[model samples]
Target: MLYKLNLEHILFLDIETVPESETFEQLDDVKQELWEHKTQYQRKDEFTAEEFYERAGIWAEFGKIICISVGYFTSKGDVRNFRVTTFHGAEAKLLKEFKNLLNSHFSKPNHLLCAHNGKEFDFPYIARRMVIHGINLPYKLDLFGKKPWEVPHLDTMELWKFGDYKHYTSLKLMANVLGIPSPKEDIDGSMVRDVYYNNGDLDRIIKYCELDVITTAQVFLRLRNEELLSDNEIVRI
Candidate 1:
């Protein structure tokens, strides 16, 4: 079935990131640094952390992730419904919990980790933060030396290109174009950092992350049906 791609081995994951600021004073320093960084980028001045944050777009403020959501899919008799799990907390705590969850759930080497832009963002961010927390990544995440297309990863964004490579489309935009209703339409990526930083609303972040996972899974199902398998068949999870 479309959902049965290596049934015992598929994990769809997404993350929500925010600017890091513990207090008002710290936020001021970060804002100053970010401002200087932006000025430098506009003037083509010397580059530094200050300038880097300013020009890095959404990656400014070090992108403190507040939520990590995962969805697991396996083939059942005529349908493909995925089970979703979420982890939310402080940046360090969430990283620790995410690594622990990965280790506990994916102890084996065969389980495949999937994400939309995971290769560029989700996967690397998780790996770096795991190392920061002195945690070892699960073996399934050992995608360092593999070629982009050869890796077990299934990036929906990459698949959407369909060999065109004209422009990079966001998950929300792709959902819109494909006529799929995105649960994330109300909470765009640009508001993610602010919502987490200002509101301290972890639930919002988790919901946002889950929406991305759902969209990614929907795209995956579409791709699988088109190129790999049909939807009516069944495979064990």
Candidate 2:
């Protein structure tokens, strides 16, 4: 089934998120209590709510998307280019822009959205945040009543699983195993919050997010047994 799909019809994406507040104390009393209750099972006496707050970005209700980098394939006359673009800044503003892109270009029924662990993380997180901001769901992100196979989304991690429901793999690990080039040395998801709040380095974070998008595309190609993308084929738009 994978071999039958056209790469041009797919949009590869990755997102970076940070806690709504710089610190747990910065949250209002009500939110503070809610956070504690929300994370009780995950915290389990190992870490306090404040200590676990850094990971709040993993939950859309407690986080805001800072950057969304997307790449799509374009080919003409045997020449192929992977065009990459990013939407960043205010959460609501960026999400609106992203929604426009989805509605305008990838709105077709044949189009698909792909990411690593997207179904579990990226896809639902974007939809939840959009709902919180009162933004209407885009065609691809809105999965209200669609059947399982009718969903126009792809997940590299799920493809790798191939029926091994208990198996899990990180993007970095999958990229390494697939021999896809990865430059994830600087900072990982764990440091994104600190880098954003403490360093105020949105540029660095955007680069990291864009790289993940590129790596995701490459990993998909590897899964399909296609040649990896060359540096010259990637265009940052």
List the global CA lDDT of all models: 0.65, 0.95
Clash number for candidate 2: 0
lDDT of 2 by residue, 5-58 (tens): 999999999999999999999999999999999999999999999999999998
lDDT by residue (tens digit), candidate 1, 1-237: 345667547788998765455432455665766555555655464565543442233352344566788877655675655677788776678777777867788656566688887767887777766666676666656666767654666677877777876668887777677766556256767777556656867677677778677778777766665332223332222
Instruction: Assess candidate 2 and give its TM-score to the true structure.
Output: 0.98
Alpha-carbon deviation at 67 in model 2, angstroms: 0.4
In order of appearance, the predictions have TM-scores of: 0.74, 0.98
- Residue 5 local lDDT, model 2: 95
